[model samples]
Target: MKNKNLSYKFYVIMSLSIAAIPVVFIVLSYAMFFTHLGITSLFNIDNHFSGSVLTTYFYIVFFGILFGLMFIAAKYFKKIIHRINTMEQTVRKIAEDDAFPEKLAVIEESEDELNKLAASINTMIDRLRAKEMELSQMEDLKREYLKQLSHDINTPLNALNLELYLYSQNHNVSKEEVDVLYQKVDYISKLVNSISSEALFDIDNYYIFKEDISVHKSLKQTINKWSYLLNKNNIEYTIDVQKNLIWQANELWLDRLFENIISNIFKHSATNQIVITVGDTLIIKDYGVGFEIDRDHETTGLSVIKNICQKLNIQLDIESTNAGTAYRLSQE
Candidate 1:
């Protein structure tokens, strides 16, 4: 397109110059003819004819040279304009859709702004692709974590529901059996509460607060809360802790944690006697069915244990087997 424009311009200039030759010739001839016709030069016709002829010859030679130069310039300019138009269209297409063709026929101009634009666009595409991949990976990890958490929460929930249904249907069931059923329900509730607390912490970074906590009082209260279950289940348990042990933490959260650990012992351990010793250290030991260390360590119970240990700045040591399970928590 540029080449064509340049050619047209050259043609126009050449045509104007050619047309000027006749005008110049005419002007010089008119001047000479007028001079000859003048009263002072009425007999100078020969001089007028000679001058007119000479001017006409000069115009012919001038037009020939000027036309040649115009033609050459027009040809090259046309090529340049064609290349520019092609590049312009390619760029417009790329702006509309980034995946537009790459092989554009551009002029061989060095280090131009268009070249830099293309490089920048390519770099941007690369970065976007990388970010997309990262987001996909994150989504996959989130899905897997949710699946595991659901499995952990549902298992105990199912067991608790079944036990409650049986107890409700058989009013004549022994008190001993009813107590065991209630203990199972309590255990499930504590587990659910722990999961809920952790979830709230993850999302909101705080738990609902009930203030003025007394650690010793809370422990005793929690024990009394589960006293009926322990007594009817024939599980001998004792609490030996100082009465004034106090701390700054949410009372409800701490109560739930204590309840969960103790209930876990009742549900899973096969021991008839459990002992709670609280002083500088808090220990809950069961002489019933102990934990299968290798198996229990891999359980969700251990995960809950780890989270609680970290939160309370306590150290947890567990020793278990078919013989019994002993869990000891030490202040740190």
Candidate 2:
């Protein structure tokens, strides 16, 4: 950015140069005094002309001229110095008040250098004000869209969850399936709430992530929750786990990660046995009839897994074959 103040070096140099002029003159005056003494001795004069009116007049005129020069120098620098100070104040006002200088306070309408500078500054100020107004309108629109979109989508979701809850009361419905339905409802509810509470639409605010999660504890709970769900289907599973590992993460999100993965296994895999391990990485392997990952399908859990892992800065790797399917989630 261009500086708002004029360079002070120019004025400083000029002032110093102006002050030196009198020193040079004074040295010449002293030299003339010595020469006059030489002349008096050569002429054999008994008394010096130091008290003479002519000598007094010479001193008076020399000092008078020196003072006059100083006065003129001060007067000349004053207006430029004042303009620089005023420009600095104007910069501050433009920043804080977002207001341009008053018309009278501007250097002038005439085409002087200072006036030209004021014109440029005013132009910049106008552009800044316009850009700010544009950004303000954009933010307002974004917030309104988030507000309406959240309402429109969640409204139907709320009605659907209530219907599902009421339907789960029937004797024909399996309690395990009902539990899964409730989990779905809870997941959707949390997704909405997270977006709303996090000010995800408010991009201007700085974001601070809070993890404070004991990885071992949270992942163990997640596994146990899925174990219960899977055990109901008579599917056997074994776990190998490490102790006392902790990192930054949300427990619910951790649960969501494992929940989605396990839920996919149950829905698609006919496997009776699975093994899970937790250490430097989370590894889940199933000896299921592995299916090909169809890229056209959004219903697959891969996309959600990809997203959450990214948010948590965890690396996800997948391997599948005719014999088995394996998933690995680890930190980088």
Number of the top-ranking candidate, with TM-score as the measure: 2
Indicate the residue-level lDDT of 142 in model 2.
69
For candidate 2, what is the TM-score? 0.56
Q: TM-score of each candidate?
A: 0.42, 0.56
Best by lDDT: 2
Candidate 2 lDDT score at position 306: 79
User: Which 10 consecutive positions of candidate 1 have the poorest summed lDDT?
Assistant: 105-114
Cα error of candidate 1 at position 248, Å: 3.7
The C-alpha stretches of model 1 lying farther than 4 A from their native spots are 1-212, 298-300, 321-323
- Residues 154-197, candidate 1: write the lDDT tens digits: 67777877767786677667665565556556655666655644
For model 2, state the Cα shift of residue 4 in Å.
Answer: 20
Tens digit per residue, CA lDDT, model 2, 169-225: 655677766666666666677766666655544534525375777665765555655
Worst 10 residues of 2 by lDDT: 1-10
